[model samples]
Target: MNTPTRTVPGQFTIVLHSHLPWLANHGRWPVGEEWLYQSWAGSYLRVVAMLRRLAEDGATDQLSLGVTPVLAAQLDDPHCAASMYEWLADWQLRATDAATAPDPTRRELGVREFQSAAAAIADFEMHWRHGASPQIRSLASAGVMEILGGPLAHPFAPLLDPRVRQFSLREGLADARGRWARQPAGIWAPECGFAPGMELDYATNGVEHFMVDGPTLRGDTALGRPVGDTDVVAFGRDLTISYRVWSPKSGYPGHPMYRDFHTYDHLTGLKPARVTGRSVSSADKKPYDPQRADHVIDRHVDDFVDHVRRRLISESERIGRPALVVAAFDTELFGHWWHEGPIWLERVLRRLPEAGVRVGTLATARRDGYVGAPVDLPASSWGSGKDWRVWNGPQVEHLVRLNAEVTETALEAVDKLVDPAGPRHPSGYRGGRSRVADQIVRETLLTVSSDWPFMVSKDTAAHYAVDRAHKHAHATREICDAALRGRAGLAERLAHNWSQADNLFAGLDARRLYTAALPSDTGS
Candidate 1:
């Protein structure tokens, strides 16, 4: 018998986008409250736990994780740091108390559950402690996970001030380095949203690899192709690879054996639904059978692995070169939307290696020479209209103009100040002598976040989102007027104004954020 000829090898990639707004003092819990009991934090903790387990078991080195700067800030927030420690301590206490409780049968179960939970929490803290967030650092260093860096605040990049947007992206990359001690080799681009020409800035900021939607790359869902000769390689997310696990209308979440997302008990505030069925009422959620769910997990994992192997073989033959399958999604979709997601992920991560499929980040792929020739890309977003609808839609049109007008006023205030070496006021903020200039810069940057208009347009907290946008814009105008008039007393008021709104680039050099490439007044 003749030996079979070998075909090109294939690859599979998954990018999980993690983000949540400045929810420090914000209210709402479980999924609300913004900051407290952060779902973003919970997701990170859980995902890290899963990765740690697999790593300890000597699993394969294939997983690319992309966390946005906005989410990273929340996780690394000093306030959040203290809160998480307390939360973990409480979890341990609860488990400990439950283990020794008065009930006989329940107590025995409690001991096991609490003991397991304690070990998890302890491992979590040990691996990802405060400041270092060891999980990100370790994964990046070990090459198991590719750290993705995004904008300063998860802004809809296309609609933001190009200058400020550029600034935000650079600053965000630096921020990621601060945590991981390694400049990110790629970014997830906030929402997998991309606009042509933006890659120029990405290249300028040292981002050699990033990802886009399959359509944007002008490729099918199963293969990733590079974009142009800019040297910044782009990987398109494979919808098949993603949808198999979680589709828009169908997914593992809808499986008969997964926990219900919308049926949590209001009074008890506990998730009481069975993975095998839907909820009847808050108090009457059917019992969940993990054994059945585990069976479901195995089935899905096998199906997913088989899909990858086939797609890989078929694609390798067609392209005449090795191919890559990238699946990207919101990290929250996991544990929050599908309670069994963590388990499913664990099961899948462990199974992929045994199945003979390789898993790795874009950096590894590129380093290994798995790339196609470059091509041009189009402007696009991952929203309803797949355009600028989220930024310029009807619900946010008026506020959008308001933002433009306010930004113009602030930009003008700085431009009109003839001399950069002029005022010597003792009250200059962060060493910038112009009291008004400082506030204008602060408010302008904060208001430019695409989240405001997006939130308003989606009717997802419309009032709050609109209020925040207008409030920041109004403050921008106020500061512009004060600075132009050379008002000295405004310092105290502006200081108080910014206390609740501290941000990463709080003392940024505004002038550096403004370049000749930006819009003159930005007022429409």
Candidate 2:
């Protein structure tokens, strides 16, 4: 399968990783639930709709979408469903307020927002009201996209305790199956973080493929390679292709014509300005024009297709075989951070196929017979320096300590609560004592999300990230203390409260943490 005799130079796959920390009942204003709702409206719903439209136009499995277990849980939460509906309605009312304002630009933007909010509300009511599962399931079932699963809380698995990592991976895949009604064959290793031997876990857990950063392959990433002796293949993202759309300094999103994400209309809680220019002040930026944005999208779509074409042709000639290039990014990058993202994505997907780029899902790539030799992957992440610094550096050392301590305490409590000698139930316990144990594990996982450290290191939303980490940590400690003290009534109350607030992975089993395949070490 590694041999490529075809005339085509390459195959292209786009990987979009979608994730958010558990934010339900956390806060409401500028930071918490608001963030979730915005991403839901701005990104998830819109991107899925775009794909569905493409599917209607005859595209199938054109890309791979990694929807982490944590995000899926929140999307399916009943509380989120009700709250999101209210949020969209509020959006419409705010747009009306903007429309009635004295400024013509504000009025135009408001009209656009009003239409978007109304349409989103209708879409939510018709499709997502029951839960995101049905909508997500329909896309996968329809063969529009391939789903990628990951840890329940999107923890940096390489930095986690073996038991915790293994447990979370297993539980996360289970959670994905429970929601979408199908098990995924591949996973988006949280943060694309991989350590030596992690692929063994992937192989053991039924993961046939996963993505790693291109550097992880040391420049030989034109094909998916097996990890060690396992059949679980690791596909390296082509950074040249991915960074073309989402780099720190220059990317399609930074273009002058796209809607600016940072500039917000304080009165109406909407962004009404175009980027205008890199150094331009938000106050002086010109109002956004969707028509102009659409033009820019078309330009970017052509640029990307051409870039992929040239790279694939060059690589195939250099390597003496057809190449496989993956352009991966966060799913939220589309409708959330980059306002014109979904439109640009649709154009790229459509154009790439027409340009003979062989657009397909990662699963399709593997099935189409591209393969390479096994290699030992180093401890790495897609973060700073392609290493563990962002998640483990000095700036987030406190968070690392916090995560380690909380995880240990949670595991200790579970070990004490569950009978060590009984039949290990799938949810990780024999029976009776599983409720408190389940809550303890849940809090622990939530506390250790990779988001906290990433946010802190990036300084994007550091304070909110800290507060979130502390909140989950506090809950874990309180629950563990109550359980240890034999305060059943108090522990039950605490668990119930936390459950209402951070409810995700409803079927999480704590016994998975005690599996013998994991190392005996308990520290993170």
Candidate 3:
């Protein structure tokens, strides 16, 4: 895998989208808050540590990072920050118990777990005590990476009412600015989802760039392409290179030497086995060996670096310019789902530059002129079939209809209550703003989130997803009805109650909802 010194090298960009829905007051264990804690400890902690190390070594423009507003809100929430600290303390206690187990295997796993847990606790105390905002802001401020922003609730843009879409997108960016002191120029459109005229909304919001699935560009992903007639660039994720790291059937993480994600030791609540074989039963799986996994990581890093080099060369030749290879993934895939992923990522980031490949953030790419001609991207997502099937398919048709109904009802209600000229609630304006209208907008945004239908279609926590959607829809309807009927007392009560849980973006004002007429085609 020697680099050809005679040839010019192309650029490589890694995009990590860090997101989870609002889970502050949600259920715990198997699915709710547990999901947040696991990813925080297993992935976020390690990934940030790796990036910090790289930054210390004078690294800059390392990767593009997307933190959706819904997830950002959770990361910055006081309740979530406190809960995560408690979870880490519990992890330490469990590791101690495991380390003292009578069985040798359990004891060995416990020893390893204890060491990891101690490191996590130290990291949490040192950098994550306040919340993720400071750490992430530092990374961006130091020029280590570019942070991406998204809509308030991560709604599927193409299916949302134009007004809601605009409001959410604007507020989401404002949320990021409030936290990090910079409004992101780029966004990971929820699920890499895009509709035809989204460029107009993006341009309206001053977005300079965004991401989409490679197929959306018809597979010409060697460079970023402008959407429609706007200068807003859409960088397509190169599935060809991305799948080499992770895909449906196979990936580097599936190697036999890597730690197995599914085989857990129920006694200690720690994974204790390697991926001996895809077909090997958990009971017969071999013990996890960190030394063996380290060796495997080194080899895989070499392989991936070579793959990127080769892809860059070939794509450059095809496109008649130095090509750009963008490999994007969910941040949780590392450390959380694939235990060795963070280490592999750090190595890849280090080795790529040494191998004569250019590494930069998406912002850097756009600024460096790694963009091509304009493209009229169609409705698409990175979901099943690279289309809207996972969101709008028959399996979740009910959710689609519900989203439309709730969005329409919410917009109409807000329009009536909010004075078009200013922020005033005709029925019961308090403190110069409509708290009731704000809550209706909040519930409406939650109802239209893309997570519910995605979970149902994937059959992962489907019941919980359905329950969340319905609950939010009911709240939205009730609040809207109360306010519109002049039941100010009831509306205020309901709004206050719902705010106990669905509270984030405290500065949100319903009057900010976009009221301009939209093109007919923008409807769901």
Candidate 4:
């Protein structure tokens, strides 16, 4: 008799891409690190709490989390570190404010819940400050989060000049080293944007695999594949599993009972909308219903598990072997954008096991021999039109032009570096000599992040994106010029000046970090 398969026998991987732009020192009180502080204080705290709660209850291990280098740098920054400490304390007050108007019995319960969040945020800050982030390190130690690496500024790697792309990934690797204090084994290729030739760079930096979207697999979403001759595996995100919780239109976040992302009460600067009511007017959104969201979470969790069950059975039948369902998402989708996100994740974690889905991280899947390869892939992006249009859209013409200059300038500087095989030892241009080159490489990568152009195109934070792209590109221009001219002292000066103004990704290599096999396009 054939053995009945009740679970997804192979594995299921969920990759959460965590990234925010380099927002240190660049903009002040309201916008920059302040925004970073909100994610750190609010979202990051919630994530850690959820992980601890799940792991404590024995859900599973090897949760794959890809924290971007730019975000890691801010987390380790003294100013950001200090600021986050204050922000957590501030979160306590907000929680208190949120709890004030509930019913008498519920008010008492709300206070306890609010206080619980307050204490957790405070404890999280304490651990992250004096030493490594408890969440980052503890999760990794438990084999809960198989940490994934990305480019220093989370740039669109394939569009960059090969050397700069190499430099960007290496520096990105270095950024991860500072926080987790360990090299990353996997990466969430920034934005799940995959270009055919980007895998060798991931291999060069010691990342075993990186993630991309489902269609890029040409229909095989559960398998991993090698890029070119490299051993690095590419994991495709399971589209069916991903859309249930947070798709563009239908998601638990859209349930009439969750906090609205669009309208905010400018006076209190809080989201004041009815969690479960139809929109009456923009001005009169109600004050968020916590209980209704809890109910919705259960229904959604059940639906999600049902989806996974059917997928597992169908895929297994097709492949003639056990199959995997890898659900990937942006981490910010959880608590930052979807206020009910953490609850949905908690319920999903709890429900999946009860439903018999063997929850796992990519590392565990790899360890268990669930890996395979299908070499060729078309050039694809996770952006609109599934192409480079997001990064090179009409709204970002200036960014395209600026990137063209930086790419050309940095490439020329790389060629000018002392020959590696020459009689004289090449400095790798270390110390002060590489400082200017470091800034050029650093600034260039930051400028080309698909995020700035992406943010502008989406109109989420358009002006800020334009401003940041120009600011970073300007620095790239100044520093790359000094490096190409062989002005060691001048290059060093520009590097220092930029650092004072924008000291992100501290462990950067000014010299071209990697050899690029891709040429950049100029006129977008």
Q: What's each prediction's TM-score?
A: 0.84, 0.94, 0.95, 0.87
Q: How well does model 1 score by local distance difference test?
A: 0.66
RMSD (Cα, Å) for all candidates, in order, is 5.2, 4.8, 3.7, 5.4
Writing each residue's lDDT as its tens digit, candidate 1 over 453-497 gives: 778787877777776677777777766666556664774466456
TM-score of 1: 0.84
Stretches of candidate 3 exceeding 4 Å from the true structure: 1-7, 421-426, 514-524
What is the C-alpha lDDT profile of model 2 across 225-292, one tens digit per residue? 98898999999999888999989798989999999999999999899999999999999999999998
Question: Which scores higher on lDDT, 3 or 4?
Answer: 3
lDDT of each: 0.66, 0.87, 0.89, 0.71
In terms of lDDT, the poorest run of 10 residues in model 1 is: 515-524
392-485 per-residue lDDT for model 4 (tens digits):
7787787888888877876566445533432332324532335566566667777787888888888886888888888887887777666656
Q: What's the lDDT of the predicted structure labeled candidate 3?
A: 0.89
lDDT per residue (tens digit) for residues 17-123 in model 3: 99898877879978899999999999999999999998899999999999998888888888998999999888878888888989898888888998998899899
Point out where model 4 deviates above 4 Å: 1-8, 28-31, 57-62, 92-117, 131-134, 275-279, 413-433, 480-491, 512-524
Task: Evaluate model 4: give its TM-score.
Answer: 0.87
- Higher-ranked by lDDT: 2 or 4: 2
